[model samples]
Target: MQQLRISIPKPCTQNWADLSPAEKGRYCSSCQKEVIDFRGWTADELQDWFANSNGRVCGRLSQKQLDYFKPKEVRHEGWSFSAKVLLASSLALLTSSKVYSNTFAKSDSAIHQNTNEKGSKIKEEAKPSDSLIIIKGIITAKEDKLPLPDVSIFLKNSSVSGSTGDNGRFTLQVKATPGQKLLLEFKCLGYATKELEITPESVAQELELEMAFSDEGLTMGAVVVSYRRYPLHKRIWNFIKSPFVKHR
Candidate 1:
């Protein structure tokens, strides 16, 4: 039972009613992000949402929801929404790279590790002891372990973004400096949106984006309709008279 308290200190200035409908919630053109509607979500679902999204999350919750889910601050040190990868050997290149993540800029600034002709790793020239880090990973369905193709991944509040290929492999190149936090957002239809937070001291390591299916996307249980059982004679009589019976 993970209870979370949500407070929107800086509420969005955009009109909520004017926003267009989106898959998870509404799409706000101003922010270029989907505004999640948590009003209908259960407490469990809300807890899971906050748990997965390390630290900050932007969503709408009612006053009643606020009161019910009160004051339990969830904080995770080091890596937030971190993933483990099967290919541990490939992550060696990043081990040497001192990755300091604030926020990264658009695609132009997106940088990755350089490689030689024989696939050997090469270091990119840095500006006065700056570290250029390359983050790569594969996205897969957590349930079936199947590759999820075309899943969109991007750094929050930036135009820099990429998608998983047919093999579910994705590589993002970004230049980050020390002393700030960089938040990465992964989104796909039918699955819950996942966010990963990177810090200044944290090493650029395996960024396996394994996402789980949303509660709504999961197979629902059969609807149990409770009804009074009738005797065979009464049932037959009701069936016989059903066609003749008319509402006033």
Candidate 2:
């Protein structure tokens, strides 16, 4: 199957949080369309969905996925509209560059230990398994190398999450194989968000994750998303409105 490479030269300004949830995606009452959230989708899944899609798609994606596609940006010196990447017979003209931090947005976080229903910390014995990945580490500030406390670390799509204690130490565990790679996010208030790729083999040694102090505010990588596939009419509409897109 051909690879799917999507680009969005124009970023949408509408806040997606207000949109109501639906079966497939969230409905944007303003644009009268459903915005699919493809935050944790695999590259093969993405390629399959785009291959079969028949209508216009407006969805969201991760910065990692963008890097994998490696969409090149070009400027037309005398054009009034912007340019975007278009797949041959499979155009994905969307506001894909609108940043959505999915990796750090995994919010079911608990610090140092697991808690029960009554909020009591649960201490369970961790047995090393071939299918388990334990990421134990100390989080620090990138500039001063001082250990940072209250840092939330979690897997991008999984429920496995943990935070650091006052000593800036944490142990996060997840279930995956040595071959499967997963995204890990480090997040803390007043610090720049950070991410890492972890595998069972790589988790053998302890980690020392670092984050930048948020001078202005917490910052994350831009994540482009699309809702659905676009048919010919929508493409024409986009062309008429922007009039600056170039495709192959």
Q: Against the true structure, whose lDDT is highest?
A: 2
How many pairs collide in each candidate, listed in order?
3, 19
lDDT of 1 by residue, 1-248 (tens): 11245555555656555677677656877777777766546666765566556445456655455555545333343233233332454475465343432333332254432224224422334345455666688899786577878788998886778889989988877667775577989987557889998864564566676887564422121111122344444445566777565311
CA lDDT for candidate 2: 0.62
Report, for every candidate in turn, its global Cα lDDT versus the true structure: 0.60, 0.62
For model 2, what is the error of residue 154's alpha carbon versus the real structure, in angstroms, after optimal superposition?
A: 1.5
Q: Against the true structure, candidate 1 has what lDDT?
A: 0.60
Report the lDDT tens digits of candidate 2 across residue range 111-136. Answer: 22334533542233332443756778
Q: What is the TM-score (0 to 1) of candidate 2?
A: 0.36
Which stretches in model 1 have alpha-carbon errors above 4 Å?
1-131, 200-203, 215-248
Worst 10 residues of 2 by lDDT: 216-225
By TM-score, the best candidate is 2
Q: Please list the residue runs of candidate 2 whose C-alpha ends up more than 4 Å from where it truly belongs after superposition.
A: 1-130, 218-248
Error of 2 at 90 (Å): 51
